[model samples]
Target chain A: MTTHPHMALVLSRICARFADEERHDLSVLRDVTFSVRTGSFVSIIGPSGAGKSTLMRVILGMMLPTSGEVVRNFSRPAMVFQNYALFPWLSALDNVAFGLRMSSVPKQERERVAREKLKEVGLLHLENHYPAQLSGGQRQRVGLARALAIQPDFLIMDEPFSNLDTITAEELKADLLKIWRAYGITILMVNHLIPDAIELSDQIILMGAHPGHVEKVVAIDLPRPRDTRGALFFQDVDALTEEIRKIS
Target chain B: MIRSVTHPQAGPWHRIHLMRHRRALILMTIVIGIAVLFGISGYFSGVAWPTLLEAVLRTTYRLALAYGIALVLGVTIALLVGWSPFIDFFFPFFDILQNIPSFALFPLFIYFFGFTDQMIILFATSSIVWPILFAVLTAIKGAHKDLNDAATIFGATGFRRVSFYLAPLALPAVLTGSIVGIAIGWEAIIGAEIIANIAGFGAFIKNVDISGIDASAVAGALAILVIVFVINRLVWAPLLLESSRRYAE
Candidate 1:
């Protein structure tokens, strides 16, 4: 892999809080800090309500941090939402081309590039099909294509495969790794499945609830296409599972 | 002994048989046939064809005017209420206003606007606004979170996001609302013209009533019905069906 000198994104002492008059304070994130190197694939794993999604919102600038800073090197950072978020009214091709249109790319070139990106994700045949017509896996693939077509330097994905069936999720995970390797874009993904994080990521940041914070950061030395049957893989998964258990 | 066995046949004929239910089709045909019969009877009964035709045209012009104004006002208000919390707090006022019968304001409108075109337009607008505004607000509130996130992440902000993402996503709901609004506008325009003595279909219908020509008023009403039906079939129905096909889950 080619090395780049600059880091892709840096989150320093980030904090998020939600307040409602009817309820007590909801502090989803506190003092969360991390840095993703250029072209690195980082995964965040936690049980439910660990602020994994909150962290992603902060990174995407959808939720502003109450304190600290999030510095991104990229002008545009694309995100794959957990729900796939494809526009119901638009076809898969139009969904992928949305960013291109926003940037005022020429109509013909945008269509051409969007077509190429959809083809890359094995969705060229479904270009004219709207999101409502697609299966769950197909919709997520379209979402991935949309993020990819933007040619973003950083890709933030929030629980992208959690809604899929196990087999389809695995297939999509493998596809994601292949795309990540081919394009060399920086990826930061959140996952509840420990094995998924181990298989797809270079590093895993485990989060704990009760005013959510990072509890552990483990560097996975295991190679790509990681074997779940392997001893080290099971060890890491078990350890992370135990850590999550303690928090809950 | 040889035994003959029969299996259920599965073929295009069988499928057609399964799809062709008699009772529902018969019922629908009967209702439509009755309506057409009444329409034809009304057409043949000494109705002044040219006069009613002119009145129908005038009514269409008034509908166009009222609908155009309501579209702009309703959509703008809905967007404001959807996006801003401050505006949303005032939504109750809108609800109360919508409940106030638009026809009840006819006297007030005539008093202020002096029984002119302006009174008719104002009445039509008042009747049309509520449905379109509510439809748009509901749509905006119910928008999918993922699409909104995608728009933001893609740098779709301000006017661009409103035009591309919000507008297209809310289009089906807006169309549905506009249809209701147009229907209301039609009723209001006719009623206002009758009460206010405007130069339109309702005034013509009142004149026919005064002349004891019941058939002409009926014919004029029938003409309006036919025009509405054609617009629904040719314009709104096809668009709605297409949108539902493309967007409905």
Candidate 2:
């Protein structure tokens, strides 16, 4: 790894709260503080309604925290939304080029970079197809290509593979790891799938919620291409599963 | 060497299939057949075709003018009402206005505009504006949240947002509303011309009634039918098809 001393992102005492229909206070996230190192792969995992999504939204600037600060070193970070928010009217190529064009990248360069990024995601052939014309897996690939084309120093994803079928999701996760290794991008991803989080992340932050809080942070010491059926893999899964159950 | 020229395969056969579903064509043919049958029977019965033709021409001109005025007023009002959130608070008031029979205002219009072409145009425009405005507002409000969010995220704010995202999404609804408005306009113009004795198809029918000339009245009605058919085929039908194709998911 290329040595970078500074942290890529920092969250200082972040808190997010919402009001219920009865007008009572509801805290989604409380006093959460963490920092992602440069070129680190971090996964946030929790059960349903555990503020995993809220954390992602707060980081993306989509939702403002009730209190605390989020600081970043990057100029513009790219996000892969949970729903794969590809513009319906735009074709795959145009969707991938959207942010570049917004930043006033010349048209030819934008297209060239978009094509190259899409080719990385194995979606170059679908350049002319609209979101509606593509399957769910294809649309997600385009979404990844869009985030990748920006060539951001940091990549943020929210349940990026939650919608895909099993086989496609596995293939995509492997592809993502390969790309992550090649680019050395700092990634913070949210996932509900334990195996996926374990397979891809260098560290997993396990969260729980009555009012959401981080329960544990586990570091994966295993090397790349960790086997799901291996003894160590099952042991880790079993321990994580028990911890998640206790929190619920 | 003698070569027989073969025409290149004319577009797709699906287009021919779509043409067969043209309701305007079918409606026109039915109307024309009825008109020709009536004319032939009237001619044999010694009804003067020249007088009938004159009355039909007068009626056609009146309907055309009234429809033109209605079109302008309806489209303008629809755009305004659809875009303004503050103005939308008065929609129920407009709804009440729509329920008021436009013919009920004929006496007031004649008293003010004095049975002139302007009076007829006023009546037609009043009849046309409400439905179009309501339809456009509904369409704008009903636009998908995802598309709106995407537009906002992409920095499609201000006038560009309205022109690009709002306008295209609202187009299909606008077309539907306009078609309904135009149909109402046709009914209003004819009724206003008849009641107010304006120089229009309705007035021609009134004159035919007073003179006891059944053939001329029939001919005037036929002319109105043909004109409406032509307008629907030439303008509204194509617009509806185009809007549906462009905006449909």
TM-score for each of the candidates: 0.87, 0.72
Residue B15, candidate 1: alpha-carbon lDDT: 52
Supply DockQ values for each candidate: 0.63, 0.21
Error of 1 at A206 (Å): 1.5
Off by over 4 Å in 1: A1-6, A21-23, B1-46, B76-90, B204-218
Error of 2 at A18 (Å): 4.5
The 10 consecutive residues of candidate 1 chain A with the worst lDDT sum are: A1-10
User: What tens digits encode model 1's per-residue C-alpha lDDT throughout A1-248?
Assistant: 23335778787888888885878788888898877888989999777777777788888778888888888776668999889988888899999999999999999999999999999889999999898778899999999999998998889898899899988898898899899999999999987788888888888888877677888788888876688799988998898778778767
Error of 1 at A179 (Å): 1.1
Most accurate candidate by TM-score: 1
Error of 1 at A73 (Å): 3.6
Return the TM-scores of chain A for each candidate in numbered order.
0.93, 0.93
On residues B180-243, what C-alpha lDDT tens digit does candidate 1 reach at each position?
9999999999988888778889999999999988777766766786788668767886687568
Task: Give each model's whole-structure lDDT.
Answer: 0.83, 0.75
TM-score of 1: 0.87
